[model samples]
Target: MSKRKGEISREKILSSAEYLFAANGYHGTTVSQIVREAGLTQAAFYLYFKSKEEILDEIFLNFERQLDQFVETGQQLNQHNFSEVEKHLTQTYIGLFQLFGANKNVIKIVFNEGGQGEKLRRRIVNQIHTNMTQNQSLGILKPEINTEVFAELLVASIERIAIRYGIDEDYSPAYLGHSLAGILFQGVLTKNT
Candidate 1:
């Protein structure tokens, strides 16, 4: 196969692996199954990722990169208006939901068992911390609260919501995402003074 064709096969493998991992737990998913679902040989699968665990690592890394980009862009959008912040956050939340929507395997494998899923977990944790700090600075999240603690709590909330949505195929990610955003916005915008 051509290099370009190989690249396509790699993506297919990743896509298929993600779905499998989502449906079955990571340990439950196997290399042979991923190759079968991707319509590729075990050899082809190796061309992209070394093992099933590696595939999970790649998926988490991809999500980490994309999510960081989303938050960075969303942070800029938040600078002008609190309303924009809410909108930006709602949109980001839905985007993440959709990304994870590709397969519940990812949520199950990474977000839950995902505690040790990747080397990128630290990056993910740090990014969330940075985002919370930015929100606190913007006067949405409480400035006095410890950003680290808040980041952990915020991630837990997001993980729980993602798992709930991931399992319920009928659930509307945007609606649920928006609902969470509503609570968060209120938490931020309600005046204590």
Candidate 2:
């Protein structure tokens, strides 16, 4: 099915706004710049969005929706066995890397911009913490380990790594997934040390 004219125009405006917001920062971008980049007039933009802040809100809403979908589909840490746990973790990380890679621009805007970014980060951390707590209950993760702290660490690490190698294409999603899993599973220090 083809998209309607209005739908196309709305998407154009969104795309243009996202790009500009990422490139110029949310406050730096203007509604005029968005409309100009979208190749639409001010009236056309208003038809889709009320103001510059509204566009940013829309962008964050879209991203949050996607994140919710990813979380829903993202499997919890496996409790069956060590190998299964490792495999599931690797898959989860791969999915996250891909998701973040696809939305690098939005991620940039979220991380660089304040306000909404903190809320988003907290949401992600909470999800991770819940998973960690579940795994801890299942004896997959050590009970002594603080799930809250671990979850925060995981979210921070993943965000930074995704922004770096994930966005820049320095590493493949599969490789990053496996590497992160290995790093998390096995401490960085050598056994001999």
Best candidate (score: TM-score): 2
Query: Number of the top candidate by lDDT?
Result: 2
| Candidate 1 residue runs with Cα over 4 Å from true position | 1-4, 118-122, 134-140, 187-193
Model 2 bad stretches (over 4 Å): 69-75, 78-82
The ten-residue window of minimal lDDT in model 2 covers 70-79
Per residue, candidate 1 scores C-alpha lDDT tens digits across 1-193 of 4578878898899989888877776787899999999999999988778778788778877766666765465357556576566788788877777766765665666755546654455666667788778777877766688988766676677778877764566677787778778887666554755
TM-score of 1: 0.73
Residue lDDT tens for model 2, 68-108: 75454323456346677677767878988888789888988
Q: Per-residue lDDT for 106 in model 2?
A: 91
Any idea what lDDT model 2 has? Answer: 0.84
Per-model TM against the reference: 0.73, 0.92
RMSD of each: 4.0, 1.8
